[model samples]
Target: MKPITALFAATLLASATAAVADDNLEKLGQFKTTGASPEIPTIPQTGPKADAIKKTLAKIKLPSGFKISLYALVPDARHMAVGPQGVVTFVGTRKNKVYAVTDRAKSGVADDVKPFASTIDLSIPNGPCFSKDGFLYIVEQNRVLVYPAAEFFYESPDVVAVPIVPKGELIPKDEESYNHTARVCRVGPDDKLYITLGQPFNVPAPEKLELYKKWGIGGIIRMDRDGKNREVFVNGIRNSVGMDFNPKDKSLWFTDNQVDGMGDKIPPGELNRATEAGQNFGFPWYGGGKVRTNEYKSETPPANVVFPQVEMDAHAADLGMVFYTGKKFPKKYQGAIFSAQHGSWNRTDPVGARVMVTYLKEDGTADKTETFAEGWLTSDGEYLGRPVDVAMLRDGSLLVSDDFAGALYRISYEGH
Candidate 1:
């Protein structure tokens, strides 16, 4: 990828564990520790609801039998994750902060959005989620921090990590690295872990570049809790801010951000299915694999990798997706995918900033997509908040984390 400006290409932060062994194909990233203490950065206050929050969500349209509510309004809530125990946690890093919200209170709204743990300077976030044991994990620009959910909350706000980037895998000093962290993470059905690290930039590193040839830096990778046996699960993903696996088939899925300026609709974001172990979806070279307007289409074209299973609009910025395993909706939604469209600015009128439900065929292909939840994006371009992540409770109610609103919204089917 071409080198960007200093601000956009901020200094590479600390790289936690990447699936690499420094073999012939490994150039692990290392974040040189700085002499700075982590202080709670000022949380970006929502200020106050400029208008009734409903006015923001009012224009959104959705399928029948679905309803949305203003769960709670907090601050800059970024990403979120839910554990088997029903405890939910999320991160917002405009000022390097983290929070935990729980449904245990029974109101189905986030009562308290409190700090889980954080650092003094990191501004980016990897989103948050957990393993079955109630261990919580949050990611900053360069590191993925893990903490026990129960221990971190109620008992103590301090989070003790299970593991961070191991000692030897740091990126060599003089190499170009993207460290585009903050890719979403989820636990696959096989009881293993999977996470996304975005493309270094919109394009792949120039050919024959040592760093690119070494460990594949700009794509998604899978690993175990020990951070061992790491491997690139997919490639050509410019960014996958939102992701989740199908609970039914155990297939890997993610939403890759679109390549910018490709018009308003051509290179839509991607909803991909990692069919095989080593699939490479087309990126930089004709996103969504369509052979139009995408300039790189003429490039040699990758022969080995699978394209996305579904295509969303350009700059839709689909951030989080979860398969509906709950019985709350019609039986047809048994395994559908609900994606949160964070919305976009570079576009003319705005495309995302709502939840989309992609209808899934038995074979795992997405046949149709619909608006499951609306109101985040406005027709006039004003938004109350951006929904970042989606998770289903044990009772099948759905929880959506709104970074713009700084609260968690729960959607449950009350009608019989």
Candidate 2:
């Protein structure tokens, strides 16, 4: 699938989300960074980016009282993680460096972006998870690498271990079949490492969709921390670039990408709970609560096959998810899920590209979804940036990274 051109997103955001949405976009002090901003107002302040930054920030729409502040300027920053103290780890495309940014809460915004490890580059590195035991694990296209939490910011990286593909499963081989963003390998409740393997190919051709469906081309895989005892945890799942372990019951949950070219308003993306190992969720069949055309004779999955609990807009590319366990926000935000939608390239309505909050039920299911942060999509659908992941600060505020902008933003509330 081609990257959603900025030109197409402009039209989609207008007729699609504008009519059905309720939240407002927010405007922080914007910089005249090079991007789209034709519909925004003029910035009032004067500085290096007085015009562009103020204008972009002013045009932002959010949920009333919340405001955003630019945190740090990164060059090609991707997924990130917060370590002990205020240490922040970021994956930068510039010279393939994994940088660490640290600051004390009392010090506030003065915290500078620190360099954790460099002198090497990893291929499209995705997920960066910190183990409770003080180790940082990041996944590369070919394998998963673990590093000492202490050595992350000060010294060169030392590869601790690398996980291998399962015995019978069709994990990606050498350079011949390098998958994009193998994503993060998380430590499940049982201390097992759960790695999300995305689909190697795009929507299967009509004649081959059914054949690949049973082959389990895309889904979740679990293994020991040292890369042993691998098993297929679930099947019938399209690409799940973002996934996490539900803290309440230790169940696995993930957001799946829906196939495109099936036309608008059908076969939407999904937010699913992997209730049990080996459970099957509809993939090539039903998506985002809507049915799509398939060559399969039945097209519909068996009743026993579980569908998503909450379906998202088709192609809304939900990435990086974490449950709110900190006390920085109001009590209402506790135990909820915060996910970053990288935005959509295929949909007629340019959905996602912002961070969203889905309040979980007492039983740990999504009760309602709310916009935690906005500004990724334009009223006319032009994309200013795409949020890749959300890292929670110890103080309860959130640190969001935009790969497009190569920058980080912090969102913290002032009053109750």
Candidate 3:
């Protein structure tokens, strides 16, 4: 062979090999770097302790005509997604398991709680969302998977999950971290899948800001369910574990956990509204709303940075949220937003550990914020149950998942 032709052939071979290696890494995920695949531990199926649940229920405080009851005993429940049929409620966890809380009796309460996708291995499988057409989407630490006919097929032992975003492609391998690893997903009315990517750092270094922006980390990204045409929907958010679309205006709303270590009450948690794409909610620059952090004090934030609609109490780790669209609740709560304050861990006096309601004005702007439910945090700074997510059942009742108590509670209302 001629010398030039031989050289060209060698270069082509090397290029092909590199492409193949990249493909393998994408398919294998973090196991490529760690050399060991993490296994999902076998979780025992057990109901919540009846006496303990009764004690917790007695401690719960709700508005007049409202009552809270044990719905299921799902361990490590973080985020929840109710199926279209309302027969199955999917619960996600920060751990390796996802649970299906089934209401077999068609009653408001769930009768059975079982592990979902038990055959497939997962990492930080904390976000479970459903499309209007009944597709169940699960977002893990590094990938997205969808289960078709999920409500029906969940009963089977081996349900196949179709990969929408292949493993290791959601975020760069170097950016992954154990902290803020939990992701939340929602299907918008525009027929797109939205996923939140919380940057690993509490206050990211200035040097890493551009890369985080380019990769859509520390913000919400939206794409087709097939994982194409992805774009950052909101930016400059610091670890938002929950989000939901307003049924009225179809705008995206989310709960963001602000910066810590700047004293307990300096920067508050945020409930923000994103009216359009490409909106930047001030993050490292302004930790919550207007409170600037020391790390980014030297840098100037974007001129048009958006602020939160409601600034919640500091250290109140806000998580999953949903707009109240059910009819069972009174007319007052028709368009209100219900979000879970997972409670704070960094304060001398613990706060939150309750469900909060944010009322909206006629113009679709936030009007006022109030505590919808409390009693999770004891007087002595101990938490009986930490609410992680708030989901609505078909009967207009709300289901609150508690990771601390390893159970789900249903809050319903009867006329006074």
Worst 10 residues of 2 by lDDT: 22-31
**Residue range 1-416, candidate 3, lDDT tens digits:** 99999999999997886576444444433323312223433334343475687688898899899989888778888899999998799999888788888888867666677787565667788999999999999999998988877798676434557778988999998888988999999999899999999999989988999999998999999999888999988899999998999999998999999999988786989999999998999888998889998988888889899999999999899999999999989898998999999999999989999999999999999999999999999999998899999999988899999998888999999875
Best by TM-score: 3
Model 1 residue 180 CA deviation (Å) reads 5.0
Worst 10 residues of 1 by lDDT: 20-29
lDDT of 1 at 293: 32
Q: Which stretches of candidate 1 lie over 4 Å from their true place?
A: 1-51, 58-60, 92-95, 118-123, 149-154, 166-181, 208-210, 292-295
| Quality of model 3 by C-alpha lDDT | 0.88
TM-score of each model, paired residue for residue: 0.80, 0.77, 0.89
Q: Distance (Å) between predicted and true CA of 291, model 1?
A: 3.8
- Tell me the lDDT of model 2 at 64: 54
Candidate 3 stretches with Cα past 4 Å from truth are 1-48
Better of 1 and 3 by lDDT: 3
Return model 1's CA RMSD, one decimal: 7.6
